[model samples]
Target: MLIPALCFVVMITAVMQTAVVPLMPDIATQLGVSPNAVGWIVTANLLTATVCTPLLGRLADRRGPRRVLLCILGVVLVGSLLCVAWDSLPVLVAGRALQGMSFALFPIGVAVLRSALGPHRLTAALGIMSGTMSVGGGAGMIAAGLLYRDGDDYRRVFWLLVVLAVIATALAWFVVPDSPGSGTSSGADFWGVVGLAVGLSALLLALAQGGTWGWVSAPTIGCVVAGALVLAVWYRHERRFDAPMVTPALLTARAVAPAHLAAFLVGIAMFVQFLAIAMFVQVAPEQAGYGFGASVLETSLLYLLPGQVVGITAAGVSGLLVRKFSADRVLMAACAVGVCGFAFVGFAHDRPWQVIVAVAVLNIFVSVAYGALPAMLVEHVAPHDTGVANGINAIARTFGSSLASALVGMLLATITIAGTDIPSERAFVAAFAIGGVTALIAGFTAAASRA
Candidate 1:
């Protein structure tokens, strides 16, 4: 019951992150904001989550996971309500920022499962919870497409999120038991938090805005250089602090470091595939030379949802494999599968079925990789450090995904038609090729980790 409850909470967070994707155009038109401005709705959420996930994870470790979990769900509920009640662009962005905090719930929930479940059940539970992210994200996009199919009532989507969040909150409050490491004497390292927050914000801001601001522009270069210096200082500060946000020891551990690297690389491949496929499926056949020209709902149902379903099932299977075999072997196999998927899409996506098959294969492997990563990390870290460890891993993956977004944007923007906004097929192929190679590298990394 506790495991399923935690998975539910994770799924809800995943849903909230993606539910707005299909509605971005409608949201822009309704709020009288430019599409470029509306893109900040997603950016603000990603930036907020990147800054907050590790901080919240530390808090959960020091405080109780139950307490922290409830608080996060509460914030999500409030964010959903705010979106439902207000129509202004600023209000929506603010609400989305709050919603972003929900990303912390994944690491916190993983920590709770680590504490609550015995070793026999732990790996499977983590697998299910991790898989829920893909499932929920796809489900959320599908739900949003259905809800907003006829008109632009985006509030309806928020209302559904509000309801789902309330249920998750109730389940978490009732089902999750408190662990033994509740009362720590040390307070959160405030200066470390500030440093990390400032550094990551500056860095992600640069990446997120680079497409609009010109990659070599003053703001972009300044933010990147400043972010790097600030993070260097923050690393030193963390080493000196008593209760650092992320301990250097945990990060550098052999068991943990490989998993983190694999997570980041796999994340890059996963997100690049996601963005590239979404765009490819939606490209007008006449303009792109070969596409289905799918609508939002059709793309959700036909392209995204099926892969998510495969991923969910594959996660369970991967968990079983981990118990029977080894996490390193399973992770290597998963990455190999991902490489095949990306390679297939890279070379052969002229037909809709080809795209669907490639995505489903990719998602299955991605889900397996996601399941294996936490299991590997948990083996090295102390039980109490689970939240922060997983938090850092999540941060790595987020950073990779953000980088993928920037890369995809650059690729598509460069290959656009002169008179229109349509991107050439070469852009999609280039993105897929990059994704395939990244997955190949990740596979090698995972295999080498076994040594």
Candidate 2:
């Protein structure tokens, strides 16, 4: 029950993060905003998540995860309600920002599982929880498509999310047991929080908006430089300051650093598969010289859904593989699959079956990485540090995904079909090749790591 409950929590957060992707155009139309303005719906949520996840994770560590988890679910529920209650862009973005706080649920849930589950049970529990991320991503896509297929009212989707949030809140309340606090820290480092918030927000904003701002544009370059400087200063401050929010030692621990690096690279590979593949399958062959001409619903059901299903199964298998070999070994093997998967798709996307198989194999890589990376990091950290450590790891993954989104957008837009705005086949090939190379690098890094 506990495992299932936590899995639900994770699944819903993942769902919330991705469900709005297909509806961006619809949202833009209804809200009477430019496509650029609608991008903020996702950007706001991501920015909020990047800033708040570690902070919320710290709160969970100090206040007990169960209480904090409930609070997060409550916030998500309110966010959904707010979305339903208003049609304005500002209001919806505000709601999404609140919903973004749910990203902390993954770290906090990891902390709870560590405290509640035995060593033998923890691996499988975590794997299932991790797998739900993919499942939820697919589910969210499907749900949005299905709900909107009948009508133009996107509010219907938020209403469903509201219901799901309510159920998740109730289930979490009843099933999740309370864990004791760390009892070591009585107060937070105010300056540390401010620095992290500003630095991460600036960096994430730059990444999220880079494609729109033009990579070399003044605003993008300024943000990158400013963010880097602030974060560098923050790191130096934390290293020397007593009672820092996150210790320098923990951040750079040999056993943990590799996991974070692997997470970032794997995340980039995962989103490349998602964004590039989704676009490739949906491109009209007559216009782009390749593609299946898939509708939104068809794409979700046939391409994305199959991969997500395989990802869920692969996640469970990852736990078993960890017991037999090691997490690093599983990661290496998974990334090998990704490298092959991306290569195959790049060369053989002419057939629908090839695309389906390619997506499934790539998702296997994502699920296995998601399952194993946390185990690698959590095993090396103290129980009390689990939330913050995993929170940071989650942020690394998010940052990677954001970067991937921008890069993929740039690549796909680099070479358009003759007169149409559709991306040419060559652009997709380049994107796939980049994804494969990223996976290879990630795998090599994992193999080299001591952990």
The TM-score leader among the candidates is 2
TM-score, every prediction: 0.97, 0.97
Cα-based lDDT for every prediction:
0.86, 0.86
lDDT of 1 by residue, 362-433 (tens): 988888988888888887888778888888888888888889999999999888767877888888989998
Which regions of candidate 2 are displaced past 4 Å?
none
TM-score of model 1 vs. true structure: 0.97
Error of 2 at 264 (Å): 0.6
What would you estimate as the lDDT of candidate 2? Answer: 0.86
> Residues 151-183, candidate 2, lDDT per residue (tens digit)?
478888888889889999999989999889776
